[model samples]
Target chain A: MAYSNKARDFFSNELKNINTAGTFKEERYIESPQGANINVEFPVGAKPKEVLNFCANNYLGLSSHPEVIEAAHQGLNERGYGMSSVRFICGTQDIHKELETKLTKFLGTEDTILFPSCMDANAGVFDVVLDKEDAMISDRLVHASIVDGMRLCKAQLYNYKHSNMDHLEEKLKETQNLRLRMIITDGVFSMDGDIAKLDEICDLAEKYDAMVMVDDSHATGFMGKNGRGTHEHCGVIGRIDIITTTLGKALGGASGGCVSGRKEIVDLCRQRARPYLFSNTMPPVIVAAANKVIDLISKTTDRRDKLEKNTKYFRDKMTAAGFDIREGVHPIVPIMLYNAKLAQDMARDLYEEGIYVIGFSFPVVPKGQARIRVQVSAAHEKEHLDKAIAAFTKIGAKYQILGKKKDEIIAQYGY
Target chain B: MSDDLKKLIIDYVKKEYLDDDSEEIDESTQLISSGIVDSFSMVALKTFLEKKFQISIPDEKATTEAFDSVNNMINLLKEFNVA
Candidate 1:
């Protein structure tokens, strides 16, 4: 039987509006692997132009690494491409188990269970661990996946302010009567490029007798001295009870996720998580590629350190050019534009200037908080960073967003 | 309890996510259907309800039907006999 026309009409109308709005962005096909410089193919016989790629999550520049590619090829040849089955149903390969074991060891956890995607990992979490007798306390600014996951749980829920340990403490006191409590948060916020206060959170978790969970999707491979994410960054490596992260971003740019934690918790999630039980296991190529990426990241501080230097250089240069950059060490840098229209206009102008950056506003963020989200990578060279800064300065001056050169502002303020 | 819950939720929204001059929220207005509450906010709302009404909200009951409007949330509370 055909589906109902009512839903189809509504969905089609919405999709059309999205296309009409700049927000309904279609993908710009790339002919190259993700890196600092890549070629995007336009329709027709249009020449594929090289552009500075600034909006990728390839923090370590390992997405197209030769070793990682070789590993993927070897896996494809030896194990075939995919398992048409879920993990528990004859899909558990030795390679999968090896990857899980490596991830657990890397994150300093007792065990880990893999899922097809991080979104599924988050969506499948709450339903498994939480019940009517439980309490789920989460940060107000957590990822969308965490929110969805919590919705599927039968637990009393509470949200403290973003990284506000004091508010978390109060909430803990408020929910002290609940049977059990679980605290969930993002290790690093993706939008604002801010690191979560995990130290304070862990302290509160101990005082309140609650378990802590963090989604380290953004922080996993680029944060901390050893790239162990927020826990390592905050010196609480073994304090967090559960950690979930993705292989889609820094790990390999392929797709996979895992819930890492105490053996019992991981075992329980493996058994009960709807996405883990229902969805097909990750392909062998993806698993192998991710395993290689992790090994590269762990073996040397080279990739993460290079990313840190690039991030600092970009942040300093952009700020020096009189642009309003979000203050942080996180790789994500938001060049604030105040008005939504201005941000959109700036992004368009930058793209025309051969720099690829994404403008976000209103629905994605707050209305007045419009900006272009620039993600710097270790793959980026000095030339690429300098080019981006120059382009921003030119367009920013054209739009009067460049308030003053850093020296001028500081001097004028009588510093 | 109803008045207090209304004030707490609205105040939290104004202080946390929205502008201080946010549009006045009527208890009967739709939150989810009207797009005021996104998927992320839905989980936050569950926590909000649990803290405010002292009731346990099952995953099966935490749907758009229960959180669509103030009236729906109030009705859900009544169904659970938590109000």
Candidate 2:
């Protein structure tokens, strides 16, 4: 296609700015399956090398599990490939209904409705239910999907401080003149592995007569005692009004998500949610594998237990090594580098040492809080953790990110 | 008082939006266009300015013209005679 000079110049300048800003995102190709150790080829033409992956969302490491693969294979043989239609049409299958039932039972919700992805699930929710008369009080640090969803809705929107119940209450009070109010937050914030104070949020919701919604994408498969979610972990299992989560993260790392909640909400989503009504149904193989993953996690707590132990081991060793690690039990551990260049350099050096991790800087996270986000999975063994920690310590010492108080580093960097 | 308000907002932005000494942000620098402060940060900043300055920013005055830069924020405050 030919472009006008004006459009071409505009896009070219934008690309140049992105490149000059040191924020241009580049994708690396993985030659092997998703796991703790995978073969990656960087620089496009380079040979693939085995690197210990610590950046995937595969918390339970079921992304390439043998049983999950086998189940997908069986599903393909039994149910065929794609649905090629939306759920309300001819796409509805027994397996699809079965998976929804399993998710509802697992989440302790009255009903569930699946979507192509959690992004779609989030995008479809707000506009359908809430109108101009309603108000949405959202955590400032909620996922981008939630922000986009709020934008699509006509409801009066207000963002409170991240996970601040007092700010939430203030917003609720400010919007009290509205007909209906809903509070939205992430169950576990992806950037920081901090779990939301759902119990407090639920209490505030009750006090203000508002409904609570949580996007538990980061805490679905192995968060609570039974891996129910943050609501279960925070002792507000039945208190939450709506829960949106993904099968793409922990539940076998396939591609599907669901909004599970009261029957009316699910029914409304099924009827009016644009994504569900427009997008094709999830492939049968993925649904089957996700169903199997839920069954596996429900039957045994082994994966979640291993993940917990690995997180503790890595967190303790890194902290003991004088590396400033964020205090959290979740696997998403941030080794603070404060300086964006330092973070990028450390991640590059770690990759050279055969450990794969990504550095997050401004826009993705708040500015001046740059860090290498290390995601530990149940798939990582003790040796893998040891190797990653050693690489981190070595990189840390080289970059002078260790052997000093976090405050000292921040002050030195003027961050 | 306007200078003090600008200083306060600059310090807050420096603490919250800056990570290193690479980028120079002045009073006239665009906060939203330059990606220093996003929608979320805008909300927080609005709350902070309202509480600290003891002035209510009406819904119509909450756009980029009023809050895009330290200078603009100070101008808005001065217009309200709060600074």
- Candidate achieving the largest lDDT: 2
Identify the runs in model 1 with alpha carbons over 4 angstroms from their true place. Answer: A1-8, A17-22, A42-46, A404-415, B1-83
DockQ, candidate 2, comes to: 0.21
| Structural RMSD, model 2 | 4.3
Hey, what RMSD does candidate 1 come out at?
5.2
Q: Which stretches of candidate 2 lie over 4 Å from their true place?
A: A411-414, B1-37, B40-66, B73-83
For each candidate, give the interface RMSD after superposing the true interface residues on Cα: 4.1, 5.1
- State iRMS for model 1: 4.1
Candidate 2, A1-415: lDDT as tens digits:
6789999999999999999989999999999999999999997999999999999999999999999999999999999999889999899889999999999999999999999999999999998789999988888789999988887888877777677777778788888888988999999999989999999999999988999899999999888888898988898988998999999998988799999998898999999999999999999999889889989998998999999899999999999999887798999999887778878888999999999999998878877788899999999999999999999888888877677776888876755
Pick out the ten consecutive residues of candidate 1 chain B with the lowest summed lDDT: B13-22
Tens digits of per-residue lDDT, candidate 2, B38-61, equal 865586688678888788899798
Q: What does the lDDT read for residue A180 in candidate 2?
A: 86
